[model samples]
Target: MRPADLAGVDVLILDRPPGGIAAFDLLETARAGGARLLCDVSDRDHDFEARIAALGLEAARDQANALHLAAVERRAVLALADAILLADPAPDAVLRALGKPLLPVTTPADLKAVLQGGERI
Candidate 1:
């Protein structure tokens, strides 16, 4: 569905910006009707750097590019989101430092804990 169609949606599970799309591009339209963002931030800049170092820069070149884009997009999404789903603890620090308001939904256990705690997000 188009971003506009997602307005007022209960959840928008974005894995990596849609084909040929950037996360920032859909922000305004996607949230226009007030939808909760379940953004997936699988990696951060630091994590990418670590991957590159481990596998060698040349081997991880593609990941570097993806990370650069993710850093820009994820930060923007987090700023406007009701909650965030990520895999890295480093992102916690990034979020805290930016003072962005978002609930971190990392693993299934974490999501379960949130539901159990009555923190619907």
Candidate 2:
């Protein structure tokens, strides 16, 4: 989707940015506003697993610790994200199928430009 289309979204995601594109980097602004950032576990060589391990997360761990468990990068990002971005071929569809808030960002400019519009990315 294009910049104008994402008028009310509060979160942004992408696999990577366009070549030489320095303007868009959705995470920068989203994190600034405390928006969650979700990405597929496979996107970056299973970094999700490492994050979970580092955070001592256990899946289906418990409701009381849901917040704590989710604080693990993978789950936390999803839990806090107002919107999730998908750039991988099937990952986007998979995330959407799981009912995660998902959007598409094709370029860094798309993200950077959005912020330039005076709205959070």
Please list the C-alpha lDDT of all candidates, in the order they appear: 0.58, 0.43
Candidate 2 pairs with clashing backbones: 24-108, 24-112, 36-81
| lDDT accuracy of residue 97 in candidate 2 | 45
- In candidate 1, the residue pairs with backbone N, CA or C atoms under 3 Å apart (3 or more residues apart, or in different chains) clash, namely none
Model 1, C-alpha of 27: deviation from truth (Å): 2.4
lDDT of 2 by residue, 1-121 (tens): 4444444555455332221123233344455655445453335322334434554535424332443333343443444445445454355333454465444545677456444543342
Off by over 4 Å in 2: 1-73, 92-94, 113-121
TM per model? Answer: 0.56, 0.33
Q: How many backbone clashes does candidate 2 have?
A: 3
The prediction achieving the highest lDDT against the true structure is 1
Alpha-carbon RMSD, candidate 1 = 4.2
CA RMSD for every model? Answer: 4.2, 11.9
Error of 1 at 62 (Å): 7.7
